[model samples]
Target: MTSRGPIVGRGRSVSRRTFLASAGVTVAAAAGMRGGPLAHAADAVPPQLTVAVIGDGRTGVWASLRAGAGGRNLEQDLGTRIIWQPGFTASLPVMEAVKAGAVDFTFATATAVVNAVPARVPIVPLAAYPLPADEVDFLVQANSAIRTAADLKGKKIAHQNGTTGTYSLIKYLESAGLRLSDVQAVSLSGADAFTAFAQGSIDGWIHWQPATALALTKLGDKARLLSDVKTYDYAFYVARGEVAVNYPQVLAKFMKIIRETQAYIFAHPAESVALWASQGGFPPNGTEQAVYEKLVRDARLSESTAVALKPVDEAAAASTQDLADNFHALGVLPNKVDVRSFLLGAQFDAAKQAVALALGA
Candidate 1:
């Protein structure tokens, strides 16, 4: 279970029910027989642990990482069985589910974490990785009159509601000394926004990820990126505060495994692209590979000096506060809330130690 090594499971299966049922013995009998049938039966099955995931329309990379250890099953090489519960499609729902105790853990952007605070989601950042700002951008159709952020004034722009993309769009406007009211803002899902832009229904589009890649590549000469926003965004690994308290060891192991996968992605960018394309219903092409590479490179995982379950330092606290302040200033939130109060510092410390011991860090 070393981070630098491959995790290959033993492929062993045992039934706890059958073992317990067959080990018919009274407490006195078991006490007398230290290495008897009961003791042997207890070693047969590994413990199973479950966590929730919000698949981002593509790339179940988290699940894929677990499967790479052996097969695409719940069992892991760390002597734990991982049962993945995936369904919530976006960050907001993931936060809500965590708060409601529907799932133990999930992932989201730092922006989503900021928004979650006022929504009363009781979740905290366990770990974090940065994403290149270029993953999101303000785009205009080719041959359009819009050439810069300033040109967006009074133009119809499409962005998803309650997403980090909205924040990106607002930042783009702010850079141009414009506010949301300076232009006609249209709220639409990424899919719908793409269609609207393609059909000339909206003047421009604001979004991230494969959506941005799709628009730029699929549209070919028809889509022009007006600006890129890599410096202001983040990707976060988050979990319920309660889960961190109750299962700090589990969180530690989980973070270690994920860090291993993140390493794999950096090592094999082209192959990672193919895997994500297959999972997300895209063709394996050079365009797709390039997109995935930039997204992964922007993460700078290979360049990160952070350990698993990194504590929230002043810089981390400031990042969350910036998101909160930006959102509030833009009227996305009613008021700016102090995000550090929700951070689980002690829990992260325990998880970090657990990972170091379990993985021989």
Candidate 2:
């Protein structure tokens, strides 16, 4: 019998369901009856890397590089094309996508990496960029009585649970000899938490950059940061383990491009800020861009010019291990995790050396 496949166009939705169900199988079958990064054939043409992009914050890498000359000529330079998948909203979703072999690369936070360690997600950390310490803060309403971290006791604070915000709150409280249970912790998404805090429902909001930047820009003097950047975490450029093991040149080329781009931005701060102003995903134009311009002018961002590929280095691992221990104490993480074991291996070491060579280091 000649079959033109199932007539899925009709109202018989079951046929449509059956047809859709075979789509994954069809894709796998087409790819030699295998799926994900591990299935790449040795002689296959260089794969198009599916990169995940987050919208809200910590967007410096994906957003800036995409719009810069650093990202141009990727196919010619790296032998790979990029398929940008934006709107993940959070790094967790991106990490999950990488685990499921849906994404090839993006920046994931150190906290996110620590969390992933226990979940057994297949990820390879290529480089670690410490979150700009000065760019983050714990913010309070200008008129609020809470003048310091110590004042946060028994106060209503809004934070996204199991995120950097929670880490900020915990560490700040610990510095003041306080604990998580001492305050009224309200768990909400970043946007919602900001709204509640701004509306006076919550006493404070603790979070990383762009959120802190947004509050300062929109609220002006009406918003006050409790202190300078409180806790520390790294923004990691990570990839699927298979990508690191199989086609490491792509990842190596990526790190090289990142180093080159950072140098370019450092050399042309004004031009870089101008580009950021024009981009939609970056800190908004006018005031927000003005904030960055001011920072660049003051040379505040100077030290971060040189980027490094860290394969579970001592300092980073120690800090991440402590972070994991603290998150466990807060009852957010079910178990204490060792950040070192999952992040280092022979595959990553080779990737790092390849990246270093690409950077001419």
Candidate 3:
């Protein structure tokens, strides 16, 4: 493996010699794409795997960094270069990428995977990352009269449409005995939701870290956390079915690298926060650090690869089915499809075990 230490920065310098060598090829041979073992190997190697990512602030940052950093580590471990794709903005776009065969892997909330699978694009969950429900804060201006969930009745709540935030908002409100019909739902992106909340256009907004922390800091005493989705474990790493099947070993190597990085992050929290902030282009105001700490504090990074596909996993599957049923009931999906088939099967389990072994779990 090439011995250059972790390359930092968005545009770090990398020589062709280093690239070829890291990819396990002779420099002269790789340069010529014909009539040689190097040429055949290069041709056989799949094009850089394109991983879709959501552009929703912190999760987006995490997805990009993890994939890039993890890919780099795997490149060194496997002596093969891995291509990292620029992430997309929303689950819809990511799903589109999967359908178009542009994205080979992705990390997103289970809710996103649920919705994508029915479209006939197989998405398999590899591992779970536990996110404390309180991490996602539902807020309103403190001076506003919306002091209780009851107060939100007939009021507008801003959230990203078709996201975990949207589901959590509905679930929380319903738990308070307020139905969707009782409150007005304002659909907006995370950034837009922040703006709407700031402009007094929306009574409440549901948001995840970094943005949640930023809103609290900016709105100060004016904004207060009204409700937190207390049991929400929102995200998971996933890969397209074709990629998972054809490159199981490669995928296993990828997951092993992620597990290692997660351990590194936990062991070196300060350094991890700094690296995340620097790579994510967060300003040096320490707000990013605060948010990173908050996420890391409540988050349980998976050390083992055979993640339990339990109630939450089932709920995620059910949620997707419910969404599809609702959409079909509302004339969305053209035909009824068995969404469960798209989930990870036995092969995935084998791959997980392989990764676990690699990680020394």
- For lDDT, the strongest prediction is 2
Our model 1 lands, by Cα RMSD against the true structure, at: 10.7
For each candidate in the order shown, give its overall lDDT on alpha carbons. 0.61, 0.65, 0.56
Best by TM-score: 2
Write candidate 1's Cα lDDT for 53-145 as tens digits: 665334536635644622333344446666677766567777777766666567776677877777767564666655554557677888899
Give one digit per residue, the lDDT tens place, for model 2 in 1-361. 0012332222332231232122222323233323543233222334588888776323354545677454466556667678888878677778788767788788777778877777767676777655556645788889989987788889988887777677777878888899999999988877887778778898888776556666778777788877644657666777776455455566777787776666666666667777776675355666777777666554344124235444345576667777888888878889978776545433245555556566665
**Per-prediction TM-score:** 0.75, 0.80, 0.72
For candidate 2, the 10 contiguous residues with the lowest summed lDDT are 1-10
Q: Which parts of model 3 are misplaced by more than 4 Å? A: 1-47, 56-72, 231-234, 298-341, 344-361
Could you give me the TM-score of model 3 versus the true structure? 0.72
Residue ranges of candidate 2 with Cα displaced over 4 Å:
1-45, 56-59, 70-72, 281-285, 295-311
Order of quality (lDDT):
2, 1, 3
Q: Which pairs of residues collide in candidate 2?
A: none
Q: What lDDT would candidate 1 get against the real structure?
A: 0.61
Q: After aligning candidate 1 to the native by TM-score, how far in Å is the CA of 281 from where it should be? A: 4.3
Report how far residue 185 has shifted in candidate 1, in Å.
1.7
Across residues 297-351, which tens digit of lDDT does each residue of candidate 3 receive?
5452222111332212445545455655544443334566454443333324433
